[model samples]
Target: MNKFRCLALISATALTLMACNPASDAKPAATIAAPLSATAATPAVTNNSSGKIVVYQAFTRLFGNSNTTNQRFGTAAENGVGKFNDINDAALVALKGMGVSHLWLTGVPHHGLVADYSAFGISADDPDVIKGRAGSPYAVKDYYSVNPDLAVDPAKRLDEFKALITRAHQHGIKVIIDIVPNHVARHYESLGKPTDVRDFGADDNTTLEYSKHNNFYYVPGQAFELPDIPAEFTPLGAEAHPLKDGKFAEMPAKWTGNGARAAKPDFNDWYETVKINYGVKPDGSYDFERLPADYANKNHAAHAAFWQGKELPDSWLKFRDITKFWLEMGVDGFRFDMAEMVPVEFWSFLNSSIKLQSPDALLLAEVYQPQLYRDYVQLGKMDYLYDKVGFYDSLKLLMQGKGTSSEVLAKHAEVADIDQHMLKFLENHDEQRIASPEFAGAAEKGKPAMVVSTLVGKAPTLLYFGQEVGEAGALDAGFGKPSRTSIFDYVGVPAHQGWLNGGKYDGGGLTAEQASLRAFYQQLLKFSSEASALKGEFVSLHPLNLTSPGYSEQQLSFARFDDKQQLLVVSNFAEKPVSFNLQLPADLIKTWQLSAAPVVFTDLFSQHQQSTNPAKQHRLTIELPALGSVVLQRQ
Candidate 1:
């Protein structure tokens, strides 16, 4: 019986073959691996075109314990191997000083299993049980490897380790890693032997469903559904369904006496507890018609192909062996994990594998679902994902002050003319905190209406790792209840501060309303990285004079043009001062311009220039203080 117990007793008699249907002519089961060839490979490039970014993606594990050692991107314990050049050259020198390109480190992989390490808060003088415990690096056992306890080498391997996309492309920044291909790891490591145990059911040799490639790819037409459990085989949790923790009694055949072979072959009722198999390839190209070729590593051909999550063939050998194994280590781009459920065949295999690392590789997909620009550009599949309906419709219409700065520059020029569909955001670690109880404190009196949801841009805005240093309470991977994520907070240490802005505010720039909302979000992301018609678009959405009082749900407006330039974004969600109406345009009175309360410009894509003053009035008349916003220019 040894040999991993004959492959766990033929994978536990494949759940008794669902009690009946064994003969559709039965036969196929004893296969092992081989036959794959057609390597071709190389494809995948995307840092998403056009621009506008403050893109942060510093996602620490959402609750469920998160303090991995050599903590991947939070190292500094004097660099015991803190990966990616020890915490990305001090957060890319405060995002190239506010004008950021991209960062997205998320969870760098190689964690075989700590699947839930008793939620890491462990007390009573600590005792790291559960084999180097930590949590949710998206539960992957090995999407290829690399977590040598996160580098400094736990015995090396993973192509020798470390490159972090060439130190974030020497400094142009742009790194993104997460890409977790669905699910795989219920104590994986099973392959073959244990002295054979076949029986797609010649009528119950202790039944078990069919073994080996069993039901082939399940798609005779599509919409599959299988759950028979005639009761008594129990099993529902202990990780069989894999979505992250489960129950229904952990379905081990419901309770056991084998009632109808535990409901016709396992899977407790099903609702995407996560086993996804539909695969069919009449020729569309995901062929697994019935696998049986490889006889046990006689050469490996991916042990006979199977696309598993539908199709995408080696997906550029699976996104170019993790960008040539993080470009040898300089690491630049990959943070995907469940990217719109994967498959544009994997972003046209990542646009031809990062086009020879041109402009420094970037693909970043953890798309936090918000109809992401019509689900990756009108249902075409994916180029990137995470726009939550244009960052919560520009943070819920500038905190319900309801559209106007010309409907917030016509909704950031209607999703900022392509070049990459929205990723812009305001608070992360899923819900709550953009100022707690979920914006119900009007995000600290709408800090300039959530700083115009980060300089109303065209993509790249994410931020979440205690967002600009001010992360308060409540929001441990929300959905409610148990919480514990860490990279140090409840005293383990390291919050550092840096980009949290607003100096003079005691102790530091984070809680004087998060340092005056990080001095208007570091001068509106250093003005969308030096504005070029706000990074594309030579002006549009020019509607002026919006009367106050009610002003369509409190005050929301717009104005972004390019005939020399005009920026007039105003967001005021009530609570006091407000007055609007800027009906100007008499040949620019020699190019009008006005600035007050901290204004600094120069945020680029190609090139831009702005310097303004003079406009106390000219049919113009604005005042937004009291939970406000205003950015007007023309020079």
Candidate 2:
């Protein structure tokens, strides 16, 4: 057989072992040829001693974009992209007023884009390879650069982003950007990379398909081919490109980012990117030494010691340098994308270096494996992991009336060991908006869910930008469909723009209903941040009321308390009003040390007061409004 045919035959057979565990399928700007105006690397000084964090996630391209066209597959000029400069002091103050502690600006990295940026020494990205008119932010092109799309000057993009970071800090909000370690754009090139740092694949031996030191796995002797485009899905609204004719010239095709081994990956595959290898062979055996089992209970110092004087994979070292470079730019923390796909050993090395630099550096990750939660947090040194499969998925079901709040109690029990490290969120970029028809189809339905998510544990609370003003994710923004605010397209968010009010940041144009929803979010989040009870021990009233007539399965009531503050949090997920004798268990009464005298409890959320003697009567007849939540504080 010919060399190409022989390679293809062998590559196809190898995919069975390589493809079984692709990290995750769930699935930017500017800058100079050199580093921007910044001092030498210094460890960032963190001010999160209070131990409560409320992160506001904003799609950088769409956050300040006032363009209302929002047409399907619109170009950047047509859609009017938001710049780093667009997020003014007014915006920062407004976000801070909404009880934000951190502003996580998504899509800050320089990724493959459909727009031409060749004037800046950047190569033009083919739209055929891109997922949207604006490309997928996950398919990063350069590790050292920011996306020109988010910059007003493009050349000064890095400086503009730094200024925004400064502005956020001034407003008392820390900043977080994404770090995608699992993959990079198929046409990855780092023009802004340091002179000393070697480019990926610079010294790779491509004759072999797999190697311990190779940055990427190879389909030797085969040229890369583009996935066939479907009739319904057109690149850049059917716009033509010189490089869009189903051909890309990689001498030895690298394994696809999602682990597809074919020269031409399926259209659904992550074909725009190439996966990074971290010493895992084609047969799924580790080529690098594994950390000891006892390392799971060890701290970052111990983990760091394990890697000292040890030779590591090139990909691991390269990613470490990239992360350290960002940290030096005064960026406080990182949100690692698809962290589970990368090996935990690499995370231990990477996160230890991060913590060693800045001990309080927030190393949040997108890790879905419940079985591997403790491993990632305790051993991998991750500060927080996305609680999607547990709380988020359950909340969605509860909102749809298909599930009960009992799941909340069950999940807390299941993840109690890692409770503090499981970050709770409702509307992030990857999930559908609560107002979307695919979800609850109503914004108010999110109220109860938000209340519980924020106070469930000592975990951080997260909110998407438009989620406050009830921005329904129904926009037809190019490659990404409705139900999610598109991270891959240039589009204006309608409701968020209403709050932006043409960059006034005054919420001048918001409807009364929208205003109320945003107000509710502000109050709840503010309470969560300041409340001492949220950091206290959790006691789910679920088990005590399992047989009570007043406690429906849709209802959940719990108490979080310490000596200084005690809070009774109750939520009714039902559509109709429900009355129940809210039961407090004897263990809770003794744990909290209830007094025999009548204790007046006032609802912080609704300001409704109730006087009940808990010592004499352990249960109180309480009436909960339809689809509502109340936070009662002892008076």
Candidate 3:
């Protein structure tokens, strides 16, 4: 045999060993399997009323930039920045075609950056406090303005953003933007605030360490000091800018975004932002009225009623107004950053206010603490919370060949009660790409994981911009390092640009492999968005198949069904081909009410077919290729 064939045979053997021996050091391959047999088949469900929610998150500044000059610490001028105009109708249509119901335009708000925009009445940011040349999106410099860098004309930035919103709406897609309620940039200034509104901390008592009326927490008589810089690093990489001075001006230094109270925060602290005071005293006691125990079961309208005629902190009211401002400006929802750090009571008040304005506004939060999931969802009135720590983390282990499918099922069962409210995602701005060296090392490895993530839950799925095209995020762009696409720099995403194809919004430049990957994502996302069974019940088949012949720990099996549609979903994580007789449990067989006659199953992706007798065998034989997945619909 040739060398390539020999290598393939060796790889197949190693994968078989890894799957058979759970403790083996061999790398696991990727594939998936699930089986169901039914003679009396129900017709495929066509109800599309309650479709699955698929969110497409795109970093607005980086989404449209086609520049390939990935210069480390490069200036925006050197490496071009994507603007609001870049996301035209063609881009929105492309996103919509991929089953995107909501498009989250990250980094739309005006934030503090090191660039000089003084000509447009905007103050230049000090590089000492900025995380990157493009600035951190969480560090809001203004609450009522758009990022000038995102607009062709800096003065008409808001108008351009409004145009983008209109275009997205025309394509039946809602717009979501980031809302960092926990903190703001060190130099918070609202040049576009209404005439009646005052900037944050404008009316604060600077000497007091804690006050309900104060917008920020103070360190009392201390001046702000920059964190100790490493010897190899300098502000703006020692670039020739006047504002690159290694000093920031802030008297009576406020607490850092991470709640570091020191005048000089640690280098790793969120030093770019200052924490907002939300009526929580320095002793960690609440200064505002706490909600009643029964209020947790109440709806958003009732929660809004509970807050009526009650006193609230100034910061809470300010954030409420900020969300209301966005809602009135045609924004459909918000992605709250570091939501757990803020008080749950504040979320109750703020989210209720948002619901009152736009009843269907999507309220997605970034909360990692599993213990606080129900509190943030029920009392805080959030629509969805990130399923990162539990579901995403466990699946990541499985993809890395460190765990079994059993762990994934256990984690899913743990959150089964609130599974509908937990949003599922494999990639986001905060995560490493599946194609990166630090992650799965290949985009194909994510296929089985993606199948499981989509079929295992009744929650929304998030797809980061370049995730479909397999962007490795290996560029060393300025302040942002490899493995994650930089949210803090002006850089191009090569794979996405290949699909962008210089404003045509076509995958003209994509290689065959990349194009194939994109096609898989497109088909899967469309199926996820339209399938009615995905919105219904789910039952795991992993436990029953654990001891069955040919079934390995690397494979997962499950069933999703309702009155209209029945789906047998399976995924293989092994690198080698796997053939197994997948059994159906008695309960599931009774649920489907199958007869003794032969039942046929059809593959949704490949259009393959198989059959088995429900009463005689109670199982179907399934064969899956390397890194393969199958969604078999009973017919």
RMSD of each: 22.9, 7.3, 10.4
lDDT of 3 by residue, 1-635 (tens): 00000011112111111112111111112110101111111111122345588999999989989888977667778888999999988898888888889999999999988788899999878888887678888899999999999999999999999999999999999999999997899989999998988999999999998888999999899999998866333436645777666788889999877667888876656778888888877766678887765666777788889989987899998998899899999999999986866777888899888987887888899776666677677777788899987788899999989989999888888878778878899998878899998889899999999999987888788999899999998887756667888877778899999998887788998999999999999889888888888878999999989878778989999999988889999999999899988888889888888778877889989989888766555688888898899999888
Candidate 3: lDDT of 351?
88
Which candidate gets the maximum lDDT versus the true structure?
Answer: 3
TM-score of each: 0.29, 0.92, 0.92
Q: After superposition, how far is residue 455 of candidate 3 from its true place, in Å?
A: 1.5
Q: Among all windows of ten consecutive residues in candidate 1, which has the lowest summed lDDT?
A: 1-10
User: What does candidate 1 score on TM?
Assistant: 0.29
Candidate 1 lDDT, 1-635, residue by residue in tens? 00000111112112221111111101111111112222121211333333365566654232112222322222223112233334444455656666667767665664433322223221111111111123334434344454444444444433333454455556676766675543332222211112232211112212222222321112122222234322222112132323323222222222111112222223321111222111212222333333322321222123212323533333234344545655555555565554433333334334334434534455556443332333233222233455554446555555645443444445555554443545556555444444444354434554655556655554556766554544543322111211212322111112223232221112252456555665556566767666655553333313434433335445655555555555666566677887655444444433434334223333232133333333443444556667766666543
Alpha carbon deviation, residue 276, candidate 1 (Å): 37
* Candidate 3 wrong stretches, greater than 4 Å: 1-49, 231-235
Cα lDDT, all candidates: 0.39, 0.79, 0.81
Q: Using TM-score as the measure, which candidate wins?
A: 2
Clashes per model (N, Cα, C within 3 A): 82, 7, 14
